[model samples]
Target chain A: MTLSSISSLTLRKTPRISDAEFADLRGFIYDVTGIDIPERRQYLLENRLGARLAELNLKSFAEYSSYLRRSPSKDKELVYLCEKITTNETSFFRDSKQLDVFRDFVLKDVLESLQQDGRKELNIWSAGCSSGEEPYTLGIMLHEMLRMSIIGWRIRISANDISTAMLNKAKDGVYNQYSFKTTPQEMIEKYFTKEPGGFKIHPKVQRLVSFAALNLNDRMALKRVPKSQIIFCRNVIIYFDEEMKKKVINAFYDNLLPGGYLILGHSESIHKFSRVFKPIIKPGGMFYRKEG
Target chain B: MVLAKDIKGADGGVFLAAGTALDDAAIASIAALGAPFAYIKPNPAFTSPEKDLQRIESFVRYYFQYVDPDSPLFNELFRLVMERVFEASQKGWAIPCEYERQAKSVEHLHDLFFRDQGASLDLVKHETSLSSFPDTYFKIKELLDSPASTAADMAKVVSADVSLAAKLLRLVNSPFFGVAGRVDSISHAIALVGVSELATLALGISAIKFFKDIPPELMDMETFWKHSLRCAVFGKCVASLLPGLTSERFFTAGLLHDAGRLVMFKNLPYASVQAMLYARSSGAPLLEAEREILGFDHTEVAGLLLEEWNFPAELRSIIAYHHDPLLSPAPRDAAVIQLADILACGVEISSTGMYSLPGMTQEAWNLLGLKTYDIDKLIRLHDKYFQELTSVFF
Candidate 1:
């Protein structure tokens, strides 16, 4: 019941990666993505990659390495691997741990609902997706999940930021290693081309998003924004007072398709702002869904 | 009372079925059958195997009781450890065969171990068998102490025991030692493994030979060695995996990590039983329970014994802090043993006297700089190596 014992519970029986496994993963990650995972952060690599192995049904990191190299969907899996190790670490994959919940729980259900409908169209609104990180991350993740099959579907991410300066940066799509601290070594290599100024985002990820300056306080503009099944208005909402929080939350709830999801910052909770949305909790954080 | 499970007799015939009610005749026959205990239904107080499992879940929960499980890092870690413990418990690794809580009270335990103050380990010097390590250990100790002694002199002492010499040669040449070229002689093995390191390992192997007198009722000696040898193998593997570590010292440290428990089990059977019971019922860790009762736990006891046996100061300190590795003078060395011991318990490789898994320090995990996947690989490796080494060792 004491504090120390409680913390120790989770740390107990953590699986370990061997020196060789660390070296192999580091080398493999470097070979593919050009980002160098240092030796000290070896624990981080294992923790992130361990989840992938469970999903892939592989036994060891070495096997995960092999899967990345030669699996039939190796290219697709590599994109995911890049997302996994780098996304959370990078501005490109901003709040993508929440994306895990989106991918596994929310998005699949949404895709299924779309499949059942006569038309194949998916809409995502990245409200306040500053410098285009959230939208670009979602684009990259979607790119892998659909296996480059975005041609058949009307997929669009309506990315809006209130600042023109930030919007221009998002459109420019140039980033540095500082923006990519959360990105895996391989992801930086795969999704970006290094330039004299900084790393350049691939046109493929950039093409999925269209950024425009839209203020949340402007009801006319909020109404004009596209209807979507998913909305990511993360840290931006925290700055608003309670009145604004409720109003903006209600706006998002109305803006979505019934049962649409709103992914938030890891620390933000929707319950205090509005009780309309049902929260779906997962590790690292929770996101909300508009209830029927 | 109705029987909740089948009561099989010595001949493997079912003497009573699940629904059988105990009358005078049935009670007489059950008493004559010499069954240790039986399940009685609708008695909420009686702990079923299922209840034992629940206790393990709660004990493990208490063991991990420090962190808010709401955080992502701990949430993931706690979930994985629970999964492992549950699997191990289901497979008969973590849970002991069901028994009623012991009747001995804390006051009774106080009377038995009260004389043995925690700080004064010299209290155990009177224990003749435990106090006296094997002659082979003392022989190497003599050489290790004497500056006049050469590596050949140490090798000659080990060679004097033909059985010890053969096991040493085979072990060095085996993949266990990772020695290059064939080591056919004790002198050559000593030169490769280091004289003191070889002596430490021999002392460990010989210490196992020394401590066979523990009663089955007090502790199962086989299970004790299984845990010890598992720690030994695991510790050796972990040491070699990390940089700038000598693997032999780790193996020896693992073997003797819980030496104090053996001493306690042998010398204070009543008090040790009480400590185990208190640890179980109160949900406190065994070391804490021991400190509460005897003022010190087995690690302290092991430290004293190792010091008396002239174990290297580093090795003595490593054993002393196996449970809390970060406190050790050489934290990494102690962390090596702690990691191995924690692994041994988590997999239910073998249960030490505590019969419950010990909680580990995050500092120890961090000190090793190993990833969780590495631990998974190590446990698999432990399984492969455990069976092979037990045969050579026991």
Candidate 2:
């Protein structure tokens, strides 16, 4: 079928999920996932997640939402659906000012401490690493700053996602040079081994990260993860309603060691949720530390 | 199959005008005769995406066929694509794809003429291996951008690079800038050459560095260096003879006038030299020989090479059409260089050095707005100063 025909058929067959129905589905997603779906933001839900409905061969948003709830065969599909609907825009050394601060303070402090303790390893976690971009970015920065190969460091990174599709991409560490728009050529050349069409992180960087499916709402899965020195749950908790945000923050507080770091996107803050973490403001960006 | 030196015969190879197949017999015959050049009708069936590719190919064929071997069309296709590549580069677009396309087409054409018969077509893969200076250049820019770095500090930065220092020293000691006495160290050379001259010289050296890996055959590296130096000497002499022209920049232009020849010879060595030899033996102009041999001439190559080096567009035009001064968009420093090249050749030959390129007297006479006697005076002045110029560099 022609592209236009397919689009038109899609538009016609679905009785334009009513405003109330759209609201209810958003509410259901937020209730199950603890992701806050803001009121009157059905347009965003429709534009970004509408493709998932079509992919499932569901005639309307209602059927897709119901399938998400009740289908026994939907576990794999649900994971993929979460991944498909999620945003994955990121690159190496993104937000240069923030990176500058990390380079000056955080990385310097970590390395100096490591030198003192005679410990070479450092662990970093990028929770909700959509399409692997954030963790890969982390890998690139760490690889560049460290200069020495990660093989000797025993540096292990844990990247978890609610979406299976994104997890798969993260595990398969292939990326085009385009994904490196913000990255310097020298960085790309140094960190990435040239693949035929693009570049791949060296196996050392790739082996540093482990990808797994995780639902943060499930407390059991949270317990399995080891304490992290640094947690980057950037832009993830912005979707969580206030109460859910508090719960997630509490989990992060329990998960991080004393004086361990927590980073959030520019739009997010943990101050209102709980007083467990204190802010460390630097020239380029901000970070928080778990209170003693 | 012929060593380049031995195949200096008259230019009477096949022209495979429209409709003839580029088959074994035709290719073999063309290869065997080795007349330095032959024209082949661009396969009409193959549509050129650039629309100008065939036109460029045809221009190369015609440039050498009719124009001097050193004319700009000998490697027209290579020159045009190179020009576009450099232009795109200035706009911050690496555009490796377009560069690769040009590299492939030029390599394919070079193979047709150079590779042994029945050799695998894949023998020469296209390379986008042109050295990129984006990062290093940015570093230099950062150094320059610091408000704290004084002009002397900046001059020291230029002086720090041994190559740039050597070139500047050579220019200051050159008769054009050598006021009346010899200028010795980098500081003295900077003072004598002036910041403008040093800036131009640094840029020129960077441009030359870009073509460092170009093969030996397309251009004689030592000879090219000598040619540029000679052209500068002649240009300096001519500019001194004139009033109000930037005499130093004129020498700079002369030093860089035939950069196109370097580009062609380096990348399209077989085609470039084939055109050169054909032009030499046939006594047709160098541009004509280059066109017939490789489908583009020296001026075009120089222009393209300059553009690739990110030299000013005006300078690129000057180099592109140096040999044919009348076709220049505006009067170029190349007119100065052309006059200088021809005058240097005349002086070099008169001083018992063997030379085989176009004559300088005619072009120099036009550009200098001087009579034959005046031309005679300039040549003598170059002959006298050439030794002094050589002493500085040595």
Candidate 3:
């Protein structure tokens, strides 16, 4: 074909968003979801919302922003926007190095401190947990490590996400092979049953986890979270800008018990924004703790 | 003369052994062979590509200094310019002149543009009037004005000038226009593309030729036109993104957007240099500096020139409000030229002596409704076309 045909092919069918228009949408997204859209990820916003605009017959992103504001069905559209904007790509046993640190160092230290306190209860909050992989992974680790130490210990994994769709998926507790990229076969066999649809988590493991819809941007809802001895907000804070990151970090600090552990995603760091979360360096990785 | 080492042709076969260059015949043979340099007393000023790369790095950095350092838009432009200039540097384009320009800034300000009445554009228009409007421009304008003219008449007028016809044909056949097949002749181009569009394009090309002798002190002709080529393509790309607008007129308007600035500089060198230096030293924009000294900027000058020349209303409107598009009757058209000019300024490859970027109206840019991906493709397309079409214009 001719070079002109190639040039024409580059012309997009989707109505494009200009820099100012993108900025307006970006600011609105950040205001509502606290998700920071950097200069590099403008395409993500475009690709995700281009079809939504065409479906609504909106001419520009500014018009779409207006629709989100003035339309009576905006609440439904906001949920759809949240679902589209937040990526659900994740796997069980992701980031083995950090998990190794968690399994070996954190489990021993936090448990030892809990035993000293003479409290048999353990509460863990998994913020922005998508598709149930992370919280369920933690549930399996708890079962594997405790191993019938006999009973009477209270263990619950409280998981939350902004997208109710993801919350529903998390409640379903089903997975295919892609979710087990790092989960060893025996571990999968230990905690899951092979159903016709996929691998279903055993009822024992499923009972230990509860899924809920929570918008972290809502300070009141963030306060309503169960106070926990450990909070695993992995890979979630990256979507927030510095201001929102500061807010989320402050909320996570308030929710975490004194001397409790907070494990973030391998790439996420609290040290940059907050000085209160004391760093606990381990052999392979690190976690932070609340210190008075 | 004697050679210190054996000289080989590009294929690595020895053409001359060492110490065998004392005769005129040998020198002529060396000349005929296009041998680059002799090994005698190895030239002292040679530098490595690594050092040249460092110079290019700083030059590109200096050009984009005023931009937001974290911006991906400027970063993409940075890559385009660096690639363009770096490629040229490999072909032995010396860039030391970029640094030496700091020493050449005008020290004293003068209203040199106004002090010489003979050089006044008003006097030139009223008295001399160019004897004629650059030959090809006159015929094109006459045919364009005559209501009775046909597509064949437009073709007759444009084809009378061989180079202008060739330029119009080559431009339409280019990737930007996307004409289906080869346009062999002027009539074929008029048939394929619309007659009025081709006629307008001829006028733009002839206008470029009209300002033939801008003093070397005023601007580098190659750099000026390369910038215009960039703006032309970029404006066309912007127009192409919109639904029903044709892109050729935008291309023509972009080509002649800065004709007023060229005239001001040519007629009043000292004053133009002083205005430029004032903009640089005071950190004011070039247009603002022009307005401060001369009571008007180049757009106003361009308005008078295009109006006096009896050019198309659309072309005149776009060029007149190019720098600030919001005031134009057709803000979208003016905005296309406005944005295209700023986008062209972002590239270090082709400069119009204003190192700083112009402030783009957000409303103007927003009205075009293009995404960054479109700009990315336009930059890539511009890199190819700018290189190909520089020879076509110059």
Candidate 4:
């Protein structure tokens, strides 16, 4: 397979498609990573992956797909595909209603009881922390609350994403004022420092969060984070097929501590997954909790 | 480095950390640092809103006293106040103290506008020509608008400017026109050029000559002309789609919309550059960012220029609010100008054209009644027109 072959694949038809080529490509993606892409998405597949073909100087989709199959260097191709197709259109404190629910009901009740016990430490994970805004937002809220109350709480926020590129950016802890759009001006002036090129979270806020790359499909890799007090795996599982979603939710249930909170995106629910977790409806948000 | 500490609060409103107060005299020493926002935020000693205003005033006074004495910062600040005070002045409210400082700065800027003749001439030369052609433009517009006006009458109006008359002849004779014979006189040229093309060409020639004195920067001779010509070409292209909008008027509006930016560049170079840089870095659309960075945008500045120079009210309105077409009570001219500017900006020009403006507000788009596809098609049309014009102009 050559670069010219892939170039022809992009414009092979107007609003272009060749069903056989698309099927082979879909199967290739599924086989390479066990992620099934629907066949009707020929336009979606072609438009997104076509740019990669050009950049890699590959001529045809055939060669590109085969490159994923034949090369032992599949990691590079997998990373490229994930980064290209993933809709990382996340914003700070996205789905505000969900966060409010978590803050008021779940955190207030669960963590307050835990605080009375010996376990005062809180571990929260924002899985798929696209470009760092979500987890950083979580960190900011937690850091400010803990500092004001003098809680002496040991808080660790771990952010994980499948895209290494996005994880690196998350670790940078710099965002323009836009991401903090909903945040009040006084908060921005106080919590964030004007860094050399952009704004930075102060070291106190920075010390609380960590970023790592992880794939949700790997159940074994998911277990390494231990029992989390709250896991915000929002806006992630909706992309997966039913079986994948069930498997990921089961893994999340197993990973959370007893009475721990599992936050899904406003639209997502775990009802179909299993009987192990019960959905809790707070005033303004919803989350799944381990049923004891 | 200034320190930023979190004010411990449940609601996430932060303030300066305890024991982290900034010395006012010390800040007064280094207020002119490259980034002043840092120094301003973390100094709890400068806590109150009034104190912040005082700090800004001291910063400005010392910024002038110690730093660049003739800096345009004062003028820029003053212009901001005038715009605010103007609205307040209308309501019979006494100007705020901050506004008084701004008023004084504006007065200084006004003095500078005249005292700096070199700058003023650069500005004047870039507007309508000091020559007789401006008078000719009004006469020609009147002739074109009148139902009974003839090409001979149009030719008589333009013939008053010998240079314009000659250019009209040259245009009519150009191979692009496909005329078998040469145009001999103004009447022949106007007849051949057609009323629409004649008006477009006359405006173009007048604008080209007006910009002769100003030296170039991001907007040089080539850039200004290219942008103007592109707008003219795009205006014609887009106006072709709408009913009742004459293509020539669209072209005229396109060429004229950014004429205010040119005026500012000539008279207020520092303010203009700062505005341009802020827009580029922040990805705010040029006009909105200009309003923030310089207190007034090119559209407003151009409106003033057009009014002071006695341009038609329609043209002035078109220039003043091209970015916000819905603001215009009259949609035809404003819509034409708005669409033209968008098409011109969206089409990729040489040197990587302006960054994408943040999308227009939904209300504004709904008011214009244009969908995404209309904008896309308009951009594509302008891209085609720009290619055609580039080959001819370059």
Candidate 5:
């Protein structure tokens, strides 16, 4: 049959990830990145990683796993793998309530402390920033809130993500309309300029933040980050295993200064982990505060 | 046919691996990507129309049951679409391309409409002045509303506008109306279609003129009207199934349900396109996606425009709450339009860049009191009326 005619036949067989291969792959993923894939997520791995395998011209999952283990460019491949596995679903001002708390309660408290001490410096870190929406959102909020007062204050916003691809996107600081879904129009007008493909964050807001590639599992890399008064790590820990979650929480505790705040995802909580931080319940959202 | 084995392209790369359902979008995407052919393991499911229809019904039911299980009308509408699918497959036609590449992200659309407009509900309300009602429309409506008005009174008002008079006669004499002969006289056409129905037709025609200047790049006006006409037909069909309901009003409601969307497309084509793409990718309902991307959805926009045009509260409620019928004051009327809107999308008659049908709430279904068998009959009725009614409107 001609190629055109042969194209009419429907493919019925699905590429199946065997149980043993799935276990091996999941285990390897967890060991390296601390992302825990449950048994039910075999289909997810099969679907997402199967495409990767096809691109790489690998025959089976076994070959793909071995290639990752033995390949000289394994580090590069790992980054690509992380990009596929990690869900980078984030938007500007994703949780308004949490942002309200950040603006109303947390920023006020932090500003008051800094004023009392006559310190002008403020450091904030956004973990798993994912294409820079969270950090840019923070920068915009700070700029709006401080306005004239922001000139004297030294502000540092450091954003880090596990995926280099995402970091590169964050560095570009260009975003589609999806990122501005929850953002108020005035804010968008004030902080973003409409461009051809998407919106570009204003230089004023983009200047306040810097992007870097850092895996949360890497303690040495985490130590390199400057201690911050507030750390926004929302929605990043849901992928980690229980042990990894505790380890990452500990790292956040260490990375935060006394009286610093740790903002997590709406569904995430620190109740299961360390008792070092106190949970502050505000009308908008909950955050953990390290004791002074 | 599920691919039992991998199909290699000319480049020797896997074109489509096994287990992927050869859906229309998949086929189109493969073709777009320059894949020549894919191998498939022949499945018995492809040969059985009954089985295919049953599968599609269940898939649709999964989403519909969430919205309103009490309404059997949605299931019937789904079956109608599936029957079309079966017929198309039997004819060896490729499944129609339903995927939209320029779908807008709902978030962006929301920002443009709501946040940018300072959260005002009046985005499209004042814009109604941009398209004034044709002089003939008001005179015709005035005469139709008057109790003592005769056919000559309405016809005299309509005849003042030569074009509208000609269009009215053509509509009346159309095949769908099944008149004995040509409707040559304006007064005779008014007598045949009745004063109120003629007024409704005039209103629909005049309303369509307002959107004539909408850039073709933003949306195809023909496709938009086809979608509206199909929704009208579906709404009327569903309305007829329910007793004590005016099918004509429901038809009008369905015809103009997505009128607000036209305004959005006309004013903010780029943002609207982004919202469509976002809806398709995220699997969010187009309405919700529109709300997320544009701040307020087309329903709200439609409500504002209809209110500005002095449309009846019932009609406004039907258009405004068609997405969520339970929320409307006129729940029954809203429910008919809502079910019809969903049915239109299910049958692939009209799509708002949504890949899946919006879920029906339990309240909407319970309000309609639908059953499974009624869907089969509705499908039969749809087949009878769709082409005929479409011709009349087009």
Candidate 6:
């Protein structure tokens, strides 16, 4: 069935998710993706997945769940489910105060430590890098920091997200004007080339970062990422329940090099978690540093 | 009409100074120069809402006459919305840190509505957790409202809930009530805080507990409550300026005005974020973005929820029509809540995702009977009560 036909049918009578179906689907989602869908948020799942059901001509969430569990193309459908469940509310230069700390304090601290060890390369990981802005923003900042003599330093910004759709967009290296709301005009002029539909990152800055699809819940997949000096997992962990949050934070801790830094969203705190990292409060924002 | 501060060019040269009355040509030239925003001095002598509305209408007419000279309705709407925006500018309304790249078109609205139709219906039918007011609270309220009931009657209802009685005692003795001696009993606490004030406080506190389940990912509950409390303080302050309106009721009205937003977040977190992002990207009001994204705005949701909760009709109307007070049946009450909401945003209280302060309708401004100078006093009052109330509530 076409979208219009399905929509017209749906318009006649809205499909309702029964309490049993909601529980089944909610538990299924949590088990598969580790996203906690509380009882109150049943409407969100119904709304987002409702479109998929219509497209597939499925009758209810029960049918949709069965299709995922029994279909030959279950892997592809699972990706779609992940896309729907995960939120992608991110932009370039988000929470400027935190970015300032990343640039002024975290980067400075990392660079100083690296210089002492006679190292020239820097590795930064942007976990849950939705649509690429966070990592690219770091790329632009690094380019500016090293300006004329950047030839000597090797920079690697490894960006990852669970959603393939977001990863594709991030890899495309183009963003709309909304991404530049907090960005200064001069930075736009300096680092991005204006394309017809959106601003494209300068090739040089784009080259500094790499994008991949990785779910933080997958411990083995996380191990594939190199131990990094800085890890950014901002605004991502809030979706996970306490156990999942602990698991992911532990993975991040294990993957982080000694003296490495972990930056979370401004509102997020790991104070309740284990004290593997020392919390450092600075003017830019809060960051946790792994003890040596 | 007058410039409140200097407008500077890219090179730091002053284009216009403070206290410059912007003529037609000057306004045109400023717009032509591509200034994103500018602040104007408020008229000191304009006391009545009618006069202020007229002044604002004239200002809008003069300013947009060249740019959108043909559309009278558009001009009127602009003037109404810009009244509080311009007023807020004088007291420091900064340009929001974000803007939307494109306004949602009609086609996108259809797609969104079609997709979320089922979910929207479910939301409408979904009974909020706080549907039933606590029995003790209702009983106490009923006793307080009746002429036959005494302080002893009110105390009897409250003391039935031992924890509630203990809390009431602690609160009345707290610095908020400022009693000379410690109030050890419910009757004493009632006498100290007064029957109506104590009833209102109890109702407010009880209502607050229902919202504790709101996810931290959606919003900081503490910050959200603080903002609600501030709006309540501002609403009460605004009500005090008008005659024949109970200020305490307005305070509760303000407290519950954004209750629908909590419902939205609890049920529609994804869509709520989408609305927020749409608002941020487009630089439109959060309500407009919400309507476009979710097929209904928070005000409508709030109205439905409040109706379900069987709140007072006037209070319900105040919250339901707060965003568009001109359309409200209880216009004055709606206007008070609207202006209080604006003041809450203006004073840098918690925002409902959108950073920009919302504009007020001319009818709302007219209903409040406030002068520009009254704002300073209102802010002072808000500050005094906000501190004390936040301590008591939080």
Number of the predicted model whose lDDT against the real structure is largest: 3
Candidate 1 CAPRI-style tier: incorrect
Root-mean-square deviation of each candidate, in angstroms?
Answer: 24.9, 23.6, 24.4, 21.2, 13.9, 17.4
Across A163-229, the per-residue lDDT of candidate 2 in tens digits comes to: 7776777777777644565566687777788766567877766777788888877777877777777
* TM-score winner, 1 or 2: 1
Please tell me which model should have the higher lDDT, number 2 or number 6. 6
Model 4, global lDDT: 0.59
Candidate 6 per-residue C-alpha lDDT over B1-394 given as tens digits, one digit per residue, 9 for 90 to 100 = 8887788877889988878889999897886575755777656885455554444333322222211122222233333334444455335643232221222211111111122333443564664543555677668667756899987888788888786776667656755345789788888878876777667666655666566455555567876777787788888888888888867677788788888888777666545665665455433457765665565788898888767655657778989999888898988889888878866765552123234345564446767777755666776777666776666666
lDDT of 3 by residue, A65-173 (tens): 9998789988778878877655564678766656877889887777777778888788899998989999999888888877786166788889998888887878888
Cα-based lDDT at residue B387, candidate 6 = 74
TM-score of each: 0.49, 0.41, 0.46, 0.42, 0.54, 0.51
Model 6, range A1-292, lDDT digits (tens) per residue?
Answer: 1122111111112266788998988887777777876554454456556668898899988898899888998778988888766657677777665688678999988988887898988899999998999999999888888787677888899999888888899888888865675677788888888787678999998899989988787788999998899999987776678788888889989989999999987545666665788988774467889998
DockQ: which candidate is best? 5
How would the docking of model 5 be graded? incorrect
Model 2 iRMS (Å) reads 29.5
True contacts kept of each: 0.10, 0.00, 0.00, 0.00, 0.01, 0.01
Residues B331-374 of candidate 5: C-alpha lDDT, one tens digit per residue:
87898888777767766632232344676666777688877576
What's the lDDT for all of these models? Answer: 0.69, 0.57, 0.73, 0.59, 0.71, 0.70
For residues A45-77, could you state the per-residue lDDT of candidate 4 as single tens digits? Answer: 565566677777777777777788777877877
Relative to the real complex, the DockQ score for model 5 comes to 0.05
